[model samples]
Target chain A: MTETNKTWVLRSRPVGDIKDGDLELVESPLAPLADGEVRARTIYLSLDPTNRIWMSDVDAYLPPVGLGDTMRGGGIGVITESRFDGLQPGDVVNTGLAHWALYNTLPGASLAKLPTLPGVPLTAFTGPLGATGMTAYFGLMDIAKPKAGETVVVSAAAGAVGSMVGQIAKIQGCRVVGIAGSDAKCKWLVETAGLDAAINYKTEDVGAALDKHCPDGIDINFENVGGEIMDAVIARLNDFSRMPLCGLISTYNATDPVPGPYNFANLLMRRTLVKGFIVIDYFPRFPEGIQQMAMWLMEGKLKFETDIVQGFENAPASLSRLFEGKNLGKLVVQVSDEPK
Target chain B: MTETNKTWVLRSRPVGDIKDGDLELVESPLAPLADGEVRARTIYLSLDPTNRIWMSDVDAYLPPVGLGDTMRGGGIGVITESRFDGLQPGDVVNTGLAHWALYNTLPGASLAKLPTLPGVPLTAFTGPLGATGMTAYFGLMDIAKPKAGETVVVSAAAGAVGSMVGQIAKIQGCRVVGIAGSDAKCKWLVETAGLDAAINYKTEDVGAALDKHCPDGIDINFENVGGEIMDAVIARLNDFSRMPLCGLISTYNATDPVPGPYNFANLLMRRTLVKGFIVIDYFPRFPEGIQQMAMWLMEGKLKFETDIVQGFENAPASLSRLFEGKNLGKLVVQVSDEPK
Candidate 1:
């Protein structure tokens, strides 16, 4: 193995919009592992909206990433060297902190063994069947609590979590509406995902479109894109509506604060409930989400989609595709050939 | 008594703001009572923020007040004439859909006798010990659920529900911060209401001031005023903070849509929960709130103040004072007074 590995680090804090120059790829010799530490080679990398949040210095649910530090992300890897008990070489594991690198050494406690899912792709462990799937399953069934005969609307419908949320709502006997950026995504959501209705937000006025389709108004709104689309959803909420806020992909790369349509008074007047949550908060129920999602997939009740970009060198550009709404589904970067 | 009475009716919908001309005081003769109807006189009218919501044509939690109809409100009154078995003359009771008039007829089912609270002021049954106190008590305890040693903040701190909310947080062993409009109100909050800190929002920079006082960030925010103050509070929320949204007094009277500061990303980044509630939703627990509040009043653990404006003729002007931030406490209008 080569002594030096390439990793991406934050070069400077982004002022308004993030650019590729803001991140730098550097080569450095892998540090020798201390006791209870292991060296692992990256196999697959996950890109999410939260990475954009880590770039800002403002106080949030988590601390801001320091300048010159490795960009934080989740990855699937195989252990190449281990000094820890129980962990052995060639063991595949899932870890939360990973850089855009080929090889890295981290503490043993930071990694969890990747549980085997028979006949499912190993890369599914990094996508819809992993954190993203668990987020949608728990966030909809637990927080939103959509009842039978209720109208459930999800934004970014063709994306990873949104796709799962629409399926889960349907399984719970709800009339589901999906909002996506393109007509093709809308058609895929309706034809493949079995959504009750799909609105192409790019071509139609979302608020008026929702009014025509959901005359009864939305009972539960799974919010993923929190900008103008959220403003549209707010106008169509029924009394006692619940909104499970998952992500804000629309505003992740925003240089300046995007001015919202601002209808907070509507929330109060409609007696609505809006809550923000991360999938990690529901760690206690991860196994349950996985079990249900797996059963659904096995029974052909759930379908999975991935927008894979080949090659480790394409990782940076692939990640930025999510912010531009270019990805059709769960976005992933193939780091290297699957381990034999 | 006369068979007919004078009542104030909504003559026209206000274009941007309400004025005296929009309402007309008119007299109409009452028809003979049918089988289930009873005649009653207006005694104590309940003025609330919900009245403003009812006036707007937009879809709200409740139906809008229709044109040329008697304005909707709740009132405690005495039966003047009865055609039903359960009600009789001089029975003091609470009823909704009561017209703002000297006297009118309603169904016997619409009225409920005001429960006797011995040694407690009857006016208390109408103010803090009534809907306002119940809203504050349940909203804080049930929704916000602040833990001991955490900080809880309330807006409109000198007003009815806000005053009770701060004291209740303190009783639960949490530090409390109050935001009011005047220096005198701030003094009253600290010296009289026993809040840990009070900020006169009109004189202080609320965002910067809150940062100095609540360094750990707000854990529970009982929102009553919802404009700039809400934006300021939203910016300082800690992870998993809860906001029990009760009212938006700031935007209640706006003729044009007021652009907000757009801080919803703060909700997502902080993993905060914001829930809007109407007091009627907590009706099943009303007895519990009333019993505890009554005991607290007797034990001197809770104190209440009211700004009673004399004469039903001044009701409209007095109600307007709430939106203007002129009312110091629970604003009520006195109709006819009897010798004590």
Candidate 2:
């Protein structure tokens, strides 16, 4: 084991887009664990749009990562050492809301041992069988309440939660349409993810595409992106449509106050229900979600991707791949090699 | 009964604000009543913020008032002649989605007969027992689902729906705060309506005032006026807050696309539920709402005001009172004298 631990510390709140020096990757000597504490080596650190939200000095769902602190994040890791019962060294676990670090020292009670599923890679725990998967499950099935034959629209459809949301809605017998930034992502949404149609928001006119595709109008909008894309979907919403507002990746790093959907009034006109949510809110119901998702995974009903960027040192820079739409599906930083 | 009917007909769709020639007061001979039709003498024509919405070519809750057609409105009227069963002459009925005219010809089945409650004046139907009252009733009770001890903030607090919302929320044991345009409206909100606090958005720093008034944070926002005022309340929303989006009077007349609330992201951060609604959507449940509101009124728990504009000729002009914040409560145009 290395004598020093490397962690990205929040340096300053970003004004618009994240820049160099906003976070500093610092090395520190690993301290001895207290009783009931476990030290885990990060195998895959999740690079989510919400990481940008945590870096900003704003009133967010969780408190902003305080300056000079190890930047807050989620990760999959293997326990290197344990003081608490049940959790043993070499047991792979989920480090919930831990740090963007090579090694995380946490209470053993706070960690969940990841069950090994046959034919599923360890990366699946960071994608389909992870927090992002549960987010898609609860946000769509719980909030959006997709009914069979309902037209479901998902933004950021090629991304982690969005991809899962599209597939889940499809499994529920909904006519699923996805909106992505790139033609490649759009193609992947329809071809690989089994979406009914996919709109490349960067290339196609979203409203026109939606009008052409969603002939019956949108019944459920799994909103992952906010801005004009949201406005377009909102405008064409069917009477009594439901929108599970899971993210606003479009405005995460906005310097100026981002304006909400232009067709906000349409929500009232159409009697649409828009509920904002974070996956952590559904933590208590994770078992139900996981069981259902795992069943779907085992049945070959769910497909997912992981864009792994090599190295823990590149954690801060790799986050930009999400904002810039450079990565597909779940963006993860491979901090260390898995135990063979 | 007069041989000719005076009706305000839409002349042109307003570009920003309604101007001269946007609507014309035209006189036309009353056509003979068809089977199931009743000729009603318009007594109290409700002038609401949605009147401006109907005047535009925008896609609204109801279809826009077609250009060159009689301006669509809601009114209380007495049946002068009926070709349908169960409805008789001298019965005062709610002319649902009728016209801004001296007389409205509507199907007897579509009109609801107003029940007489001793000590409740005819105007109460237009104020607390009518559509606006029902809007306040369901928007707060049904969508917002206010819990006892929760903080509820209502915008356009002096208007028909807002004033009623505050009183109902108070009755439900909520801490009610109101945001209105003028000191007089704010004064009435705090004193007469029994709200915890009131902020004059026109004269006060709305955000600062909201922070002071809603110390615990807003749990329910019965949004009426959407703009900066809505933005301020949205910013102070607590986790799991509910927003019943009833109206956007602020954006009704905007020439350009109105920007939605800047604190739109706060909705996601707080996991708020925002649902848009129009009162007509709750038509089936109006009896329950009306019974509740009427009981409160008789018990002296509900206080109301009616800003009656004299004459049908002034119906088009009286609508400006709603937009300009000139009216205290429900703004209604008295088209004719009530039956003596």
Candidate 3:
């Protein structure tokens, strides 16, 4: 039997913003499964800011996606044929760099069997039940470690990982404040995500707002957007404040190098801990994270929003959604149908 | 009995470099020791880069030294007269804010009695065995936590704190690389302090030098001089790198606000940690740190150089020695004579 596969292939590295023709969806024949390998049908493609980083030829967490190669992505896929003993044809797998494709053929050991999380859709496996959720979990609990009554501030608080960060910080008894671009996003953070305060970074003077909101100064900063917003939050950092340096989305598209925060000396004066972490570091405990996040989701204490664009052809353009502040929560693409 | 006290008073805030009269050596009549007070004669007055920070009306580890107030310092002093039960005549006391003065009247409880070492000089109390030593100990050991075979880079490696940071990192079994302004300081770091490598930041391209010295990337960065030096070291950081931000002497005398390191994003890219710390935070453990450092010193494994600028009259002018790279190691002003 033969099948036609549709995949988004990198045409060229992006200069600033990813444009059309940068990633071209090409048609190809699916390869027959070999020993220790499996053929999988892609279900969901995770569009993230890191996707842009991978699209560029700059130094990043992973090597830049090679020209003419499939666009790197995180996604959920269902195996159709397997020769490896570790995976069966009926298995649904969650994996990294699964590519923006309708089907894939790879070693079976590379993919993890998707955890059974009831009430959580397959879309969540690309988001809250995947690396996105785990990023929020460890970046908050492990790095920031917010305590009760402490003022916890999260930037990009309306984004997928950030929204979870605010909710989880609230669960930890922290006075959560979020920094987002839109007034509507601010409203959702306060009303829906349980954040005590939301600073619309676009309209509000963040420094003054932080002073009024975090009167005791910020004990923890969950940074996603790095720019003046980070500088404003850092200026109000209390002694021994923790900043889990995750993403600097503001600079991902910049043509030149991004300058360090002007008030960076606060890192010393306040004795702050600024640590960068990647979700991949917590892969060993992904099962534990997924389980905890599942319970929170089932309990209604944790809420996530998935802003998904259908069709693999739209995958490349959708990644710009994160940098543009266009996506409401988790930004992803659904490429193919999954079995019920 | 009555005595005349001489003090360096803050005449004006410095702009770029401190001038001759930025601090006025004013003579004041010493007040008689009241109940619970002592008349202490200053011995060795520490002239440090922080003096410039304190001189300016900017935010620092301590409040800015106000105009007309006696200049704040750290020093070793001897009690000439006492009315308090806690102190008596001829008792040597070490304290912070020792003031660039010949005499001071205060409650004796604020001062710590200097610990005696058979070979250690009175200058060691204000230098190696004091706050400067403690800064190096905690910033390197507690913040960086360098392991065996790790590459440790220390900027301002010839200064009081930076010198010790490199030496202690050596004791911790790490490859020590020193960054200093002059060839002499570089030579001393390698020849006297037993550093693995030395980079004369003035003569060599720091980034290239770092590449050659730390071939495997830097594990711990004991940062003292900020700006280009910091940016250079940060670019060479390994994954999970730790930087103990101690001081930013290069920016101390700047007329304008100092810019942040241009490559600060390495904190995220390399998953590095940049933690700012002050030694006072570890005051409860000072005795423990001093004990360990003292043992290291006694073993001949640790060596210290004292830059003593004699005469209390030159104390204010001598402070610029730190910023000018005139001092070899621990810079201090000998205010009064020690008993024979």
lDDT per model, in order? Answer: 0.82, 0.91, 0.86
Superposition error at B250 for model 3 (Å): 1.5
Clashing pairs in 3: none
- Write the residue-wise lDDT of candidate 1 on B58-139 in tens digits: 7777787799987777666778788988898877776555667767688997666666676666667666677888899999
User: For this target, which candidate reaches the highest lDDT against the unseen true structure?
Assistant: 2
lDDT string, candidate 3, A7-112, tens digits:
8899988889998899898999887778999878888778888888888886776789999998887678888888888888768998576677788887888876
Candidate 1 per-residue lDDT over residues A1-340, each given as its tens digit: 5577778788787775567777777888877789999877888877777777887786756777889987777778888889888678888887666666777688888777776776778877776567889889988988999899999999988888898999989999999999998988999889999999999998999988899879898999999998778888988888889999899888777777665447777777778888989888988788788888887876788877888788776776677777777887788777766789
lDDT score for candidate 1 against the true structure? 0.82
- Superposed model 3: Cα runs more than 4 Å off: none
DockQ of 1: 0.66
State candidate 2's TM-score. Answer: 0.97
* lDDT for residue A106 in candidate 3, whole number 0-100: 79
> lDDT, candidate 1, residue A243?
92
lDDT (Cα, tens digit) per residue for candidate 2, span A115-208: 9888888998888888899999999999988899999999999999999999999999999999999989988998898999999999899999
Better of 1 and 2 by lDDT: 2
Sort every candidate by TM-score, greatest first.
Answer: 2, 3, 1
